[model samples]
Target chain A: MVLWIGGRAQGKLALAMQKWPEAKILDVSETDAKGKEELLRSLEDALKDERLVWNHFHLFVRRALLLGMEPSEIWEKVASFVDERPDLVVICDEIGNGIVPMEPEERRYREETGRMLCKLAAKADCVERIFCGIPVRIK
Target chain B: MMILIVGGSGCGKSAYAEKRIMELSLDGAMRYYLATMQVYGEEGRRKVQRHVELRKNKGMLTIEQTRDVSEALPKMQEGSKVVLLEDLGNLVANEMFGEDGAMTPWEIVADKIVMQLRQMNSSLDHLVIVSNNVFEDGIDYEEGTRDYLRALGMVNAELAGDATQVVEVVAGIPLMVKGKE
Candidate 1:
């Protein structure tokens, strides 16, 4: 899997689109996957074909968390989906770089997002970090 | 030489900075961790404790200076060759809002901080600064927050230009934005 991660407005989506003009784009930033099963189903449908760009994967994780899905459960679904289709590109915003929030739920969401991103980075075949519209490949 | 590390909280910026400073520190050279956060409540103490724990056994001295970045210089002037400023956000906040901080305008605050950092950097062989990426949240904050952001943005821009290395840590991975390996 190819993973593109960066802060908001760093042009991760733009870079991904430019790099894979022929790929199908699936932006789940506004997805309300109410539960683990729904999220997994969405992922399965999205990863049915190769050359797919999964945008805002981090928000999907947050939605899953809010819908009462544990981090392990979310990771299991993502890992299986990506393992089945390794030829996919993912773009996620780096959300854990700001100050920790006062709300406990926000803090947990931030932590889980970062943790899951690390796991994804480890499994990814190519990892590039976007900064100021520039791509820096670290893995 | 100066190195700047920028990232979101818990993104392994401190870890990366610590490891980098350790690598840059020569044998027997003094190392100082310039902590800029002012501990107050339980949460504050816990955060400081966590950082202290991280630096445990790292053979580095810890100096707490919440405001006036240059004030910590005298204490480190005694042969300290390497220093790591844990962060610039808190330092900026303290200067802008702290009771004993400089209550001047954001531009003045930014100038003061940049000047202090330059003075401090001039005396050290290596200075590794850890800063935040607080501008991406897209939230329209209040005037105070905007001012704080402006000051931090200016300081980061100025120092980054002078830094020999600038890295943004993402999930424990360091992506070099400036300078070579």
Candidate 2:
């Protein structure tokens, strides 16, 4: 799987679309997945094809935090899916760079998202960071 | 040449920018560190102190200019100079809201910064700017916060266009987003 990570509005989804024009693009940001399990199930079905684009995967992390789901548990499920299907393309925004949120839930969300991104980057065959519409291969 | 180094907080963008400046500086080339942050309280003071400690003995002359970055150009010597502007986030805030709590239009603030950056680029031997990545939080902030972020995003895009090299530092590793090296 290929992981594309970068700051918000850095053209990550646009680049992903350009790369996989024929793939099914699923934007989790617009999805109605209320919990981790539902999100994972939807992602598993989406990854059935040879090329599938999962945009804004960090939104899933946010939902998981809201549901009080453990990041490790979510990562385990995601790792299994990626292992099962190697042609997935994941796009996520790097959201942990700003000032620490004052709210406890926001803090937890940031921490969980950071940890999950690290794991995704580690497992993905390719990792690229987009900045100002420029894609830099990180791994 | 202009180099833009951007990243999240504590991602080592400052350290990387400083090292890049040092490498670009030659003998007798004046090294200036343009500090754009105004230390407000304990947290701000500690952050500034930590940055000072990080650059200790680096032969840098720190120029504390919270806003009006272009004004510092006259103070710099007329030789080969390498300047590392620590950040654009605080600079944008300072420009948007002044000392007396007056608000400048966001477009003007972005324009002013971009103009200053362009001016600095033409004058200096090497210009390395450090900026924070601020737009990834999923929450919809208030109108004021949203305006600030929009202005910052505009400024960063302009800087990236003018920069000869753009690097995003992650976990102390410099990833080149544009240009070679």
Clash total of candidate 2: 0
Runs in model 1 lying further than 4 Å from the true structure: A1-139, B46-56, B100-103
Residue by residue across A1-139, what tens digits does model 2's lDDT show? 8999877656567667777799888776677887767866777777667678878788877876677777777787778877887888888888876668899988888888888888889999999877866777889
Minimum summed lDDT over a 10-residue window in model 1 chain B is located at: B134-143
Shift of residue B77 alpha carbon in model 1, Å = 5.1
**Candidate 1: residue B173 Cα off by (Å):** 0.8
Q: Write the per-residue lDDT of candidate 2 for residues B1-181, one digit (tens) a residue.
A: 9998988888899789888999898666888999998889999888877767666567787788999999989887777888999789999999998778778888899899999889878998889999988777656577777778777877887788888899989999998878889
**lDDT accuracy of residue B146 in candidate 1:** 77
Candidate 1 lDDT tens digits, B66-167: 988888878875775799997898998888885865366888888999999998899998999999887665333787887887788777767877888888
Per-residue CA lDDT of candidate 1, range A27-78, in tens? Answer: 6655566666776677777766658999988788777888888889888888
Evaluated on CA atoms against the true complex, candidate 1 attains a DockQ of 0.08
Q: Rate the local accuracy (lDDT) of all candidates.
A: 0.82, 0.82
